[model samples]
Target chain A: MKILGAIIIIAASTWAGFEWAKKLSERPKQLRQLKVALQSLEAEIVYGLTPLGQACIHLAEQLPKPLAWFFETVNKKLEEGSSSAQEAWDSSLNEIWKFTAFRQGEMEVMRQLGATIGKHDRDHQQKQLRLALIHLEREEGEAKEEQVKYEKMIKSLGFLAGILLVILLI
Target chain B: MKEILDVLPDTIRRVIEQMDTDIKKGIEEIRIRILRPLEIIVDGKSIIPDSDGGKHVITPQESGQLLNKLSQYSLYALEEELKRGYITIQGGHRVGLAGKVITEKGQVKAIKHIASFNIRVAKQKVGIADRFVPYLYDGKWLNTILIGPPQTGKTTLLRDLARIISTGDIARKLPSFKVGIVDERSEIAGCVNGVPQHHLGDRIDVLDACPKAEGMMMMIRSMSPDVLVVDEIGRKEDSEAILEAVNAGIQIIMTMHGNTMEDLFRRPSIRPLLDMGVFDRMIELTRANGPGTINRIRNQHGKEVYCKKVI
Candidate 1:
């Protein structure tokens, strides 16, 4: 009965300690908050998209073809032992990122990371986070552009209808 | 036969090293008659055969043994060379293999055996078949048959007939009819890959290395010629196909390996064909049976024309 009581006490202590450690853990909180904010931005754009806006959003949401191909080439170059994986990855990224205009605010993060993280362990991690944020911003920007185009098309249609009504009256 | 081999190039022996048993045996009996000795051809570069310390007298037995070492690819190539009709061998030998044949199926197949090969040094008798040319055509064309035993110049005459029918000679003055040759045996055209190696004439379109019945039908479809020339019709399929061709308004000039018309009646497979009478003429050849030469040419309605008697 004493051994049983000791076992119960150890289990309870372990459970309490785990609960305390979890309360102290900040990494989960940071990651969860970051993911939820990024996802919310995506969901807002999806819901607000007109047909043209949705199409443009879909295009912006896609990983750029050249960038994907660049990553694949680096992986191939690493396999062929032509260059180090880090070097290959950095060079390929530079080639691919040339097309990406580094903007401030939502986009400055990508430019800052691209400038600072040339070839380092945290470089890839920094760039990956920046790319994800930038791609989300691009989707939003394209969706807004599509909204403008849709407005122009509707205005032109309204103008055409007005002209037709005048002609019918004549 | 020895004379026949004389025309084959020295390189051909090595080319046929991987030949089958029958061909190897056939090569063993061939002799060179054209090219001079001490010739060795390796991939077209003429080197000298070691010949065991400069012994030039390579007998046919030795030739056969040497040929057994060649790859089968070379044998196929050698067959192609033979299909071209004539080539000089290691010691200036001449050989003939392609011919119209009566295959076991009573169909026309190409003859590849250098059997009945004659090496008469290829004396170009320009007007060899001149006298017999006019008789082959009866108003339109008398569907002729050339019958002879092995080596009795049956192929020689067949080749000549093809030449004459395509480009008529000056004396007989034939109108050069459109001739479709099923040269499955390569005899009439001596074709190598559908190109004539011998002078089968410009009017002849040949189907080389094909079965005779199939070749005949193929010719009828493609050429649409008035007359079709093929050698050796003994296959039931060939026998039937020839009848089909005749029914389709195509005249056949063909040959069979037989001494008498009775030989055609004897075969159970060819018997039905004989009764059907696709071939309207029967030409009996005999070196011993008659005063000799091309003995007799008889019409299907039972009339005979006697040629020069071989004394």
Candidate 2:
């Protein structure tokens, strides 16, 4: 029974470590997806001249989950007709941020983007989108660096900590 | 009309909605200005709705919200419209904007801080041109020019004429003609996303919001329309393009802002077209007996063909 408890405890810690490592890895990938989404948004606004609400719905359909859910929620809020574009965008971002691996810096970048997304002309909108892309690129680089530096360490630390706990308990 | 109401702020929309159906039906324009009472034009008269003993004065926030809704929260898509100082919403309703002008090196770049909006309601009166069809169409549709002042329903007449020509009136013994409309201001067809909201029939094609001169030539080359319909042509390039279309054996129906035949001759840009007799019929319209009242119809030689009898 004691051996079984040790095995279960180690397994739990290792699983928790893997989950953390996965999140660390996901940050960079999610940031890249966000950049692609913003690029598509720029194309839609500049070339297609699609309205922002419509563009969000389009992105929702084209993108993968979490991001898709984010855009879909934004579109729903916009279609509700009560909230402004910025309000819809910010609210959706807040709701989806908990589900994402995005940090506060990335959140701040997106919030800034929300403020001007549909307010300006094409040239100004394009500039604002590009600015957000630059900030996201910086965050993505940091995420990648953290993932490389800590992912393996965290995985090993989980096993090591579990062994230490087992020793102390025994 | 619903589209127009959707863009208005909540309070004004509610008041307008509560108005009598007669006033609602006759509504032509809804004018909103910052710090001013909301005014609606019905048959060329402005009527401010009574709002519980206090007039519903338009606030700056309301105007901002109006602009936001009109743009569909995407002002980036309205780059050209901001420069043009007007926006054509869905259902062909036009909102004229007045604001601080942003200029770049002597050129008007765009309108910013928009504080005034004039929402012109486009009501398509189908069959308003039926009586005139017998006069305007002979063996082939004539190169006709509808002359009128602003708010005299020239576009309404032209829209009906396009529908009639494109659909073909069996009762009137008129066969459907291949009609192409170069709707420069998006007025005649009230097109939304290049598709006309008006009932212009299946045999018609519209070049929405294209400049008159270039669009005329484009229509002739691509659409091969039997009759080309254009609105508000007074520009120099418009006359040149009309001459080109005429030489290409295409019948052109167009409108100009003028009260009388003298108004046509007064403009140097239109003088050459008049001298060449480019227009087969010049129909003058006036609001004297309510909008769309045909004052007189003159042949190419300036002889009266049909005149409204003063009763």
Candidate 3:
């Protein structure tokens, strides 16, 4: 047999070995941080909007790119001077809220997830939290699913590469 | 009649006229260049190759491509036979085509769409299979696949093997063995009916234009000869039939398109056959810087078991 043929076999084996190892290495703790962040976002939406989601919005504002450009566009359209928070909310979220979605869509839908706590809708918030828990499971599978996709991609590449190696060696 | 058709430079009108009067519908002519030891003509143009090697630069035109299109002649696959150096197309009718080798990753898949080729009319020579009588009998008829890429003389080899195995011997005045040939493309015995137009010696019976898969099944039940010789087994279906023949203790001689034995092993389509260990011998051919000719034949171990001079 040609040397190239031998190389192809070796390359295929190595790739298979790597994929086998990757599947064995992932831990549940490494995924916890992202899960926590997703839950916090869920809480804000379910309740009367938490300080965390508001903080995220502020960060999105300071992002200095899409948020900054969008804020600038709306600020210029405003009738008079207003504080940055109101300015940011009115210009950024207000413009977005007018769309069919933000006003009467997901927010209106999420309103039933929580119980009314001192004028806040508790049933809307609770339902939102329940859905968030379900969504967390969905997010967990994303990583594992991605790993599977990666494994397949490796196998396909390895197959072709192995064949080429065989040809080159021969 | 073929000679009369050969004389006129067949134009579109002549083509229509020929069609009206039982004329063949493919290409009317093909310009080919010969490296040596042969002669050719197409549409009044002398077909010869550039001296840079056996590269016959044919002009790509409608009329130029016409003569090699397809034919109604007996199952000789005239053009394919010619390309493999089986017979020479002296004048009038010429065959033409060349196939692109489909390679996957790097392994050869199969040859497809013969772009350039030749058609050589088959002429029978009466007795030629007598030489291999000793090698075939006493349970000597080994199931074989006469493998070689396009134009490596698979059909010619097949015709000879069929002739030898069918008839016991032609030279020593030995008893002719009753042989059945499945000429799937009519390229083998050039059978017009049950009769063979080409020389397959006296011992061979031919099945023409029948698919190898169907022919094998048909021949097994009907002919039941000591040996089964066929040409160009390509797909998995064809292999299955050959396998069935092999499993039934019926000896088979077939061919495939592969230049070397190593190449034969790498082919996914043919790989199963190799793994199954059916083919006793694999004949490989390569055009040796000249016209078409066999390079050598290798045993199952890929050793040069047999070599022949182009006589």
Q: Rate the local accuracy (lDDT) of all candidates.
A: 0.52, 0.92, 0.51
- Candidate 3 — which residues are off by over 4 angstroms? A1-170, B1-119, B123-139, B170-175, B289-292, B307-311
**On a 0 to 1 TM-score scale, where does candidate 1 land against the true structure?**
0.45
- Among all candidates shown, the one with the greatest TM-score: 2
- Over A40-143, each residue of candidate 3 has an lDDT whose tens digit, in order, gives 54454344233322434433455434333433443343212222222333445445444211123333322332122112123443454556555545544665
C-alpha lDDT of candidate 2 relative to the true structure: 0.92
Q: Is the docking of candidate 2 incorrect, acceptable, medium or high quality?
A: high
Q: What's the best-to-worst order under TM-score?
A: 2, 1, 3
What docking tier does model 3 reach? incorrect
Cα-based lDDT at residue A27, candidate 2: 91
Candidate 1's C-alpha lDDT? 0.52
Candidates sorted by lDDT, descending order?
A: 2, 1, 3
What fraction of the true Cα-Cα contacts (under 8 Å, chains A to B) does candidate 1 also have?
0.00
Model-by-model DockQ, in order? 0.01, 0.83, 0.00
Which parts of model 2 are misplaced by more than 4 Å?
none
**Highest-lDDT candidate:** 2
lDDT of 2 by residue, B1-311 (tens): 89888888788899899899999999999999999999999977889998888788998888878888888889988888988899988888999999899999998889998989999998888888988987898989999999999978898999999999999988777899999999888888988888899888999999988999999999989999999999999999999999999999999999999999899999999999999998899999999988899999999999999999999
